[model samples]
Target: MSQHALLNSVEHSDLKVITQAGAEYGDNLWFTPTFPQEFRAVSAYYPIFFHKDPATDTFHAVALFGFTHNDNLFLDGDHWQAGYIPLSLRRQPFLIGRQRFKEDGMDKEQRVIHIDLAHPRVSRSQGEPLFLPLGGNSDYLDHMAELLETLHLGMEDGQDFVENLKRLALLEVVTLELTLNDGSQHQMVGFYTIDEARLAQLDGETLAELNRRGHLLAIYLAIASQSRMRDLLARKNQRLGL
Candidate 1:
């Protein structure tokens, strides 16, 4: 679906809403009502889920999901918070995987068209077509589905094989260099970004490295761990010796 599509909840069948427990009340999406507004513009609305886990007083894992939203932003759901909350609360919300921006006062100049694989929040949702870096949505989801299947298996083996790889190699830092469809390069690190658009371009060997290293699988399992997908992944893992 396009980015302008609306996401709903399965049970409620209502547009998914996140009600943050605080004095200031957080609602809506993408730091602006633009998403809801865009939904009204078009007659398309699909189901999505918003889950929050505030196990520690310091961190929360707020997961937003859409059934058909085939974007990389949501796929990297496991790359959540690290470090302590800083004195500047300005970035604290987005840093811990919470939605911000509507309060932060983003640039109205940024048209809701182009892709921002690196956006702190927008990077994770499959809303509109902002960037086409990964190439057309040809085999993107298919490849990712297969990879996620492997991750499910690995997680079932009682070995977070991917995360272990990172800990063993001590690769806490990484530099990502992405080549967009236009051959332009965008680089970042520390829970960077990986949209389906760009992921489609990755060769099998490269994806294999990502899967083995745990970086890619970490994201996959993080998102799939709590769902039935984990069971699916586990079954696949047994078959592949993952």
Candidate 2:
């Protein structure tokens, strides 16, 4: 397939859903389209959200599509004080959207593809308006992918794992600790891993040589040529019936 098609496929793939917090928070973090025919969808182009749980060493990932009330989405605003100064200056950026699902609980949720909205819950009140981010393809997937990579590696062996990961590839390393909607906590680490066989097969110079010359695209292409390590963990879990 063409590069464009491959990227599209990567961006549009379905997500697996899992719940790690309060049982009352419901199962399946993914959401479904609430009113696709009437409104312009913002997250449809890329519909996945990832959450990592360090305490239990689990990863919660979901893909969701749908409409949210304006009040629930994140919006840029201005802030002001009682004085003459402009209040807009005090406005801060915060998550204000709700997770809308086709059904209220996990029963039907298991049958669909969706992800939990990373924001607060949406109120069903009539006056509420859900504001959405401008980018249809938010960095949600990229963020999640990076987050999962970091968290998974950390779980494998702590600081030693991180050091080894960097030595194995040419990407920056970072870690994130997150609190999910249900009040559960988790962690994720980030780094890239390359396929040694593929790098050696290159008729030209070595992988290190390509990286040293700042051939970023070529480096990523070579790294991705290997199976995404993230999937390996997922498969391992499935094999053990996790």
Per-residue lDDT of 184-208 in model 2, one digit per residue for the tens? 5555443223335544565444445
lDDT of 1 by residue, 156-198 (tens): 3323432333333422333534444445555433231123445
Q: Who wins the TM-score comparison?
A: 1
Alpha-carbon runs more than 4 Å astray in model 1: 1-153, 170-172, 181-183, 191-242
Give the TM-score of each candidate: 0.18, 0.18
Predicted structure 1: lDDT: 0.29
RMSD of each: 22.0, 20.3
Q: lDDT of each structure?
A: 0.29, 0.29
lDDT of 1 at 134: 44
